[model samples]
Target chain A: MDSLNSLIDGFGTALTPVNLLWAALGVLLGTAIGVLPGIGPAMAVALLLPVTYGLEPTGAFIMFAGIYYGAMFGGSTTSILLNTPGESAAVVAAMEGHPMAKAGRGPQALAAAAIGHFAGGMIGTVLLVVLAPTVASLAVDIGAPDYFAIMVLAFIAVTSVLGSSRIRGLASLLIGLTIGLVGLDQMTGQQRLTFGSLQLADGVDVVIVAVGLFAIGEALWVAAHLRRSTGEPIPVGRPWLGRDDLRRTWKSWLRGPVIGFPFGAIPAGGAEIPTFLSYVTEKRLSKHREEFGKGAIEGVAGPESAASASAAGTLVSMLTLGLPTTAVAAVMLAAFQQYGIQPGPLLFEREPELVWGLIASLFVGMVLLLALNLPLAPLWAKLLRIPRPYLYAGILFFAAVGAYAVGGEAADLVILLVIGLIGLGMRRYGLPVLPAVIGVILGPAAEQQLRRALQISDGSASGLVDTPFSVTVYGVVLLILAWPLVRKQVTRRMAARR
Target chain B: MTTGTAGPTPGPKRAHWLRDHSELGVSVLLLVLGVLVLTDALTMSVDLTQRGPVGPRTVPLVVGGGLLVIAVLLAADVLRGGRGEAEGGEDIDLAEPADWRTVLLLAGVFLANAVLIGPFGFPVSGALLFWGSAWALGSRHYDRDPLIAAGLSLVTYFVFDSLLGVPLPGGPLMGVV
Candidate 1:
């Protein structure tokens, strides 16, 4: 009942004209960029961060939230229609959606995807509204050691689970941590790796790193692989959903949110695991399991819903615990810090209007997204028909403009190129980029927490592991780090038996 | 894993051992980089505070240690012949040469932006950038490319400069715009 009242209050803030406009703009821009081959919400939000400097916090965040969910929706359109996944979460969608497109049931796939997005997003948001306060209350009891342990767990889980190879993932994470160390050391106020440059005083901006890596690096990599090629164009099918299609897909849509929400809330658990799990679950449970690789509607619906739901779930964690489960969430956390607002357990109690208003706007944004996606999907599809050259060129242009917009520093452009090359190399070597981004965002905060925990316990080494709660958190981290080795041995014995 | 009848499975002969252990090579390189970073970090003079057990070096040291452990583990895995292939589920085609045109074009775009951004400002430099990228991406329609490029540059100019209030570089041709 308390949640119901506050949700109505949230609606009041979300429905204001200015907030609505911000939401619309975010979704529009999100969809536009999301259709592009390499750009994702993380890059989009990074590009927009400097621009959002002037807007009210609530309005800016409303737009950022819209972009996050909007990209998840838009990413599926490309996956189904063109077999090109603009984001990692959409990779599963592409697997099944493309086959469906080839079978001339692309419209049915699109309908399932759109409906799934709505269902998943709504359910994820509902969980956020209900579960966030409870989680936050628990968080308030956490001390510096506990927080440090949690971060360590997050670092381990994210790098190991997100990619095909855990080694490559850790390497990627190390690179990010190194980059995070580039600025002035926070504790001593001394430069660690600035190389004595005056611009090194403030350290590299998170926006520049994100834009360079995602937008510029992506462009450079694509350019390196560019080829004159063509394929049998997949035609856009009818846009309307048949009643039978709806009946078939609704159950999957409902199930997707339930699966995705918990994954989103867990630290280091991201959309990829939930999406893959959703696909496997749907395949095992479906009455028409045979239809899975042959344009199954459930295949398209379940994963797409789970992906969006997980995205919403990540937002809940970010706003409440100040923890980011994904790359985009990390960047947004940086954005929040830039505004001088440290998001934690007390945020809702401190700024109820901002939190609730943001929640309300998500509901409104989801509605607008469905309207934009369902009827105008062809327009979105036409984005692919545009020459790749023009699209990529536009990305480079924006990259330079975005870099220069922040203080008009020419050196930032140079940094962008350098980082772009680094990004390209990482991609070529199969390294995940998210961990590095995490390191950059959380490095200083982690240092501060470690110092605080130590100060409380004197100079003793045992001080680091003194608290019961902290010890438990570290115990969990150790298990996560060790699980891979255990799993490998088990798998080897199983294979030997086979 | 279904071993499809593509070929004789190469008799499990471990075709191209170097390719299989590429990730191992990468892990070694990362370990070296981590060592280099640690050396650099250690070179800095630290002013210790008496107030706390953990100092400024604690976080970096921990991260560096984690990197070393992970890298060594990865190298061991690679050395043990535990690494998988590219997982294409298909036979490899080795005859294709790398695409160099895109490499040159992307480099050109970055160079042009860096050089021109200060002198010509955001609009003109951005226009060139847009047009060049479009050309690089394989747009053959010359008639439409420049117009689209200029239009995109201008729209970006307005959004960043007017709407967002970001002060984009206006190079030597600043007043002309």
Candidate 2:
């Protein structure tokens, strides 16, 4: 009943003409950018962050939420149409989707993807509404030491599990931490590593770093690598799904949300794992296994649904516990903090309007996305035909404008360029950029909790492990950190035996 | 595509060399970066805590120590010639060479913005910024391209200036925008 009332209140807020317009705009821009290869939701949000600076907090967040989900929808189009995936989560979709396109059943493949996205998105939102409060209440009892332990666990999990190489991921994370440590030390009010510069007093904006790395670096990389080709646009054909297609896909859509939600809620579990699992599940379960690498509609439907559901599931954890499961969630967490509204257990009590409004807007936005994407997917496909040179150049131009708009400081442009180069290097070296992003966003918060815990214990090293909860949290962290090594050893032994 | 090719024993000697050398290069770079960060963190002034056992240096020092350990491990792995499967193996072959022409064109666009933003102001410069990028991207259909870019820049200008009140640089052509 309480959830219902709050949802209704949220609908009231979201239905306002101004808020609705923002939601529509967010989804539109998110889909457009999401369709672009190499750009993801995090980059899209970061690019739009500067532009949203002046909107009311509630309105701004509503739009941000729309863009986040909109990216998920937009990503599937490229994955299915082209073999190229705009986001890592879309990789599974591409495996089956591209084959389906090649078989000339492109429209059916896209229809299944859209319908599956709708199903998963709706289910995930329901879970969020019901689970967020309960989880947030549990988080309220956690002390500073426990928080510190959890952050350590987060850092370890993200660096080790998210990327191809643990060493490179950790290195990238440390680099982000180093960047976070720039400017004034939060505790001492003393400037450290500022090198006697006034601009350094204010720490580098995470938004600027994110935008520069994702948008600017992506633009530069695209500009330098994109081939200019005028390929004929893939014919979208009929948008409607046949009865056989519908019957085959509905089960996968249901199965996907079930499989994806829990993974999205977990710390290290991202969209990629669930999406891959969903794809494999569909392949193994399907009556038509031979069609999987050909033009299986289930193959396209399952993973696309899983990806969108996982995206929604990430929001549940983010809004309630302030733990971001993906890069976009991490950036959104920063955006929330920028508005001075910490999203946690207290958010429901303190700002019910904002929380519910954002949630309601998501439901509305999902519907809007379906309406826009389903009938007009062909138009979106035409977006792919845009020459690479102009697309990338536009990205760079917008990135520069966004960076300059933030602080009006000339030094920011230099920082943007430097970070862009670092981003390029990370991409080249196969380092996961998400961990670095997470580290930067969470570094200060973790430091604050650690300092607080130390103060409570009177600076004793044992103080960190003194409490039962903290001890348990540390134990969990150790287990997570050790799991990879232990698993590797087991795998090696098994390989030797084989 | 032949499964019977040499019983699937990793790769050729040249492949092994390439793998080991790249890892070595990366390990060296990581070590350098780790050491620089560690030294910088350690040199910062720290106030001793009379009441608590932990101080401001705790987290950085721990992170620094962790980095050093990882660096050492990475170095050892690289030196020992432990070759792992190449990352993104599927896509590596698909990647094409860098397009320098597009890079230069984009660079020119940014340079133009930097030079003109202060003098020509937001309206004129903003329009050029949008139009130039659009043109560069391959929208040779100038009839609709410039109009679309101009509209986008104008809306952006209004949103930044009027709605959000972000105080964007209007430059010399401010009133027109």
lDDT (0 to 1) per candidate: 0.77, 0.76
Expressed as tens digits, the lDDT of each residue in A137-227 for candidate 1 is 7777777777777677767777877777777778777777877877777777767667788887788887788878877877676665554
True-contact fraction per candidate equals 0.56, 0.38
| Residue-wise C-alpha lDDT for candidate 2, range A345-401, written one tens digit per residue | 678888989999999998999999999889988888878775554566567767877
Cα RMSD of all models vs. native, in order, equals 4.6, 4.8
Candidate 1 CAPRI assessment class: acceptable
Determine which window of 10 residues in candidate 2 chain A has minimal summed lDDT.
A224-233
| Shift of residue B164 alpha carbon in model 2, Å | 2.4
Candidate 2 deviates by what RMSD? 4.8
- What candidate 1 gets wrong by more than 4 Å, as runs, is A230-233, A267-269, A466-469, A489-498, B1-32, B48-51, B64-96
Measured by C-alpha RMSD in angstroms, how accurate is candidate 1? Answer: 4.6
Candidate 2, superposed: residue stretches over 4 Å from native: A230-232, A466-469, A489-498, B1-32, B47-54, B77-94, B99-116, B119-155, B175-177
**Top TM-score: which candidate number?**
1
Question: What TM-score would every model get versus the actual structure?
Answer: 0.90, 0.89
Scoring only the A-chain of each prediction against the true A-chain gives TM-scores of 0.95, 0.96
| DockQ (Cα-based) for each candidate | 0.37, 0.31
lDDT, residue B154, model 1: 77
